[model samples]
Target: MEILLAIIVGVLYTAGVYMLLRRSIVKFIIGIIFMSNATNLLVFLSAGLVQGNPAFVNATTVDTSHLADPTPQALVLTAIVIGLGMVVFILALKYKYFEITGTDDLDQLKQTDEHS
Candidate 1:
């Protein structure tokens, strides 16, 4: 299962990077989303896969060998929130840029870049 997930992560990363390299603003946004999802999946896999195990123990003397680690789960949750904020911020920027420039082409933006 881990191997399959790892392969999936690799594929997502590849696709994200490919999209990121495109000249379209929409593709870039999608790439960012894909990359964030890939990172979340990675964090999840790093937390290890346990079956039929409790996440937390109530007793002070309880054994923790079979319990799933909560840190990675928490980290992934936090990362997801942060990623959402980043995507929203980027989308806002893209919207404003489009409103001003009337184009979403990276090549056109580069012409402005050279002028500046």
Candidate 2:
């Protein structure tokens, strides 16, 4: 199962990089999102999947035995939030591009050649 997860994560990262190289703003944004998810998954896998007790302070010391690392979960949450912010910024940039130029194509954004 762990190996499978690793494979899936690797695939996602590869796809993300390929898409990110494209000139389209939307595809780049999606690629960033996929990359973030893939990274988060890798962190989760590395943290190890334990099924003991929760890492709460209120609970008695039942036995940390094998608790899934909470650090990765917290990190992933922050990463997801950051990814959302990036997406919003990319979308806003795309919107501004369309409003100013009336087109979404990257090749059409040549302002140096066109007399504005």
Candidate 3:
């Protein structure tokens, strides 16, 4: 399962970078999403997968060796929220840019920069 997940993470990272290289703003946003998800998965994988192990401990004397680490989970959750906010903000910027420039192609933006 870890091997499969590692392969998936590699594929996602590749796709994200490919999308990032595209000239369209939409593709760029997708790349960002892909990268974010891949990063979260990578973090989770690093923490090790413990089956049937809960993060909570009911007793102080109980064996805690097999319990799942909560730090990675919390980090992933925070990253998700941050990634969502970034995506939303980027979309809003795209909308306003499209409204004024009538184009989503980043190459077209180069012309505007030259004019200024």
Candidate 4:
């Protein structure tokens, strides 16, 4: 199960990187979102997944032996939210660029002295 998860994660990372190399601004934004998700997954995996423990303390128990590590989960959760915000911001930038320049291709953004 762990190996399968790792392989899936590797594939996601590769795909994200490959997509990010494209010239289209929209694709680039999407690729960045994918890459962020991949990074979050890698961080989560590195923290060691618990088999069955939840991240809450038991009613009477005080020791921290049986509960899952909460830090990684919290970190990943925050990262995901931040990633979503970044995706939204990047998409807004893309839309603004499209509206102002009429193109989404990075190579086509050459500034002209007359068009300025």
Instruction: Pick the TM-score winner.
Output: 3
Ranking by TM-score: 3, 1, 4, 2
lDDT of 3 at 11: 95
- Candidate 1 per-residue C-alpha lDDT over 1-116 given as tens digits, one digit per residue, 9 for 90 to 100: 88899999999999999999999998999999999999999998997877677586776847888887888889999999999999999999999999998998877876645755
Weakest 10 consecutive residues of candidate 3 by summed lDDT:
107-116
Off by over 4 Å in 3: 111-116
Q: Give candidate 4's total backbone clashes.
A: 0
Q: lDDT of each model, Cα atoms only?
A: 0.90, 0.79, 0.90, 0.82
lDDT of 1: 0.90
Error of 3 at 108 (Å): 1.2
Q: Give lDDT for model 2.
A: 0.79
lDDT tens readout by residue for model 4, 1-116: 66777887888888888888899888887778778888898888887778777877758768768677889898999999998998888888888888888887867867663465
Clash number by candidate, in order: 0, 0, 0, 0
Candidate 2 weakest lDDT stretch, 10 residues:
49-58
Residue lDDT tens for model 3, 1-116: 88999999999999999999999999999998999899989998888878778798776748888888889889889988998998999999999999998998988877647755
